[model samples]
Target: MSVRKQQLLKQHRRNKRIALLAIIMGLLLLGFIAPLWLLPLAVLLVWVVHEAWFADHLFYSPQDDYQYRFPDGVQPLSLRLVNGRLQLQESSLAQQATVIAKVQINSSWLGRWFDPSICIGNDQQTFERGAHGVRYLNLTGQVEALTTAGLAVQGRFCSIATQIQLYVFTQPSPTAGNMMILAPHADDAELAAFGLYSGANNVSIVTLTQGEVEAEYYQRLGLSQQHAAQLKGRLRAWDSMAIPLWGGVAQTHCVQLGYYCMQLPKMAKQPDVPFASQQSAEADIRTARRHNTIQLPGDATGLPTWQNLLADLAACLMHFKPDVLVMPHPEIDPHADHIATT
Candidate 1:
């Protein structure tokens, strides 16, 4: 045998010996320190760690006779292992191209490793160890007539066989449209629809309540009055700032209905629930009466508070006229306000 082949064989033998020694030591340690009930888990963990460590350094020769052909009328594609790194090459007329490739690495003991990666051009991609074996990567880049890409996979493992399939496609342009997000609280819209808000041409957020009940609840929890006030103010401020930032435009409308927090559904079900503090409730009644926003059938004294809420929401819907409406799922959501809003 050649000197290089001899060296590789010797190194592989040494790696096997080291791996065996590590597993024995781990078993002994677990037997002494780990409880009987945890022995199985400890053994499994030790075996996994040993296998991963072994795979990280092992190298396998690629089958020289293996040949890969590109799809009919598509760009020519080629893959080869060079100095422990996988190199992918493709010929294209476009200046930039998106390459999507699926790579399968098979190990005798440890199941198949599905590491799919995308490469635009000469970009380098890294693979990290995953639960099953290793997670793949995606690459993006710009190239001339010919594109060359290299992937450096961590933890060199001998693959029984490696299969790679490549596909090329263009990315679609961004779409524009009107989007409406309804939130039971100030921050809910940002939390749920930030992606839509950022991408859509026009976005409107309707926050149903001021969430003052949160401040009251915090106070009831023994927080200082000043701290509670600060928390409430911060929540409102973040809600306002987050929408503008996510929407990428100041033209977005933020409609605040200023309803009592934590009481909408309760008031709808039982109008006598007393949604606000006595002082605030009396003040709100006076304001509603003056604005003529509160119109109830029969006596005003017997009206349900959620009727006004529904009316205000209807008015908002009529004005915004959104093509898409994003709201909380009624049955799936556990929050009373979210369910009520839905």
Candidate 2:
């Protein structure tokens, strides 16, 4: 299980204990104390019990508001804004980034039973920050939309200190990804699917149906079924979204390169872009260096030959001394070379 899930479970158990205590105390007071005091005590007990019994649901419910935090020095981030705009102060970020919170509400029968904190409401925000340092997310947006339903999400995170532009806006046509409406929707299967599309505007993202996912895989990674379902569903709903997530792209590669440099024994100075290259392979290498902080070969981690395919990476880092570095998550299945690089 993920550290987040474990923490959440711990918190849940604590809340449950608190609720049980409050109830017991309230009952005792009712039997032996004044009506006014006892009545207030009873009410408090009820509220606490409600929170404890339904903490998970209360958490994941759309109405609940939350903020994710990173301790000092954490890096990388996975952010989600459902019904709110995220305001980030680039300067306040520390070197490392960690997910301080994962809040949401799931209104499924099994969810409510297996995890009683399930409730029905219209707001949801999840945080998946990577790295091991602290960063800040300024939730300085309006809360009016958050109080309502029908998904509105905006997610962004730094891959290698350079933030890629990923915005999801709302439109009439369901702009971004393909939208899948759930038919005969059950509580466990209410959400269909949506795809992430390259629309004319930013908000062109899609929604997906739940049945079309391998939930267990993500669940094993400590993500809630709902969260994993949505991500996979979104991919299925969108065209070429899988490419960015799977294949290596220059921009994405650079992002990873920036992240890797930050961890080396010594960092490099940022590279200078001489000119744009027409060849993608050459261009990818060049662009990777251009935005990089460490100048060629200097920022790389391992020795040249030992690194093999990573020779270019080492060279890129050495040429461009970036403060941070990032690389794609090495694929563990079906591809040996990719896994080796990852």
The candidate maximizing lDDT is: 1
Q: What is the TM-score of each predicted model, taking all chains together? A: 0.42, 0.23
For model 2 the local lDDT of residue 183 reads 19
Residue range 1-342, candidate 2, lDDT tens digits: 556657666776787889689777867767776666567667776777565545443223222344443344444434454234333334333323221323233233332333222111233332322211222332223222222331233332221122312222222344332222111111111122212222212211111111223546656767676566544433333322223232222222222221121112121221232111111112122222233333444234322122222344555444434432222234323223223333
For candidate 2, give the lDDT. 0.32
For TM-score, the strongest prediction is 1
Sequence-dependent TM-score of model 1: 0.42
**lDDT (Cα, tens digit) per residue for candidate 1, span 51-88:** 65446423322211223443566652445445545555
Off by over 4 Å in 2: 36-45, 48-342
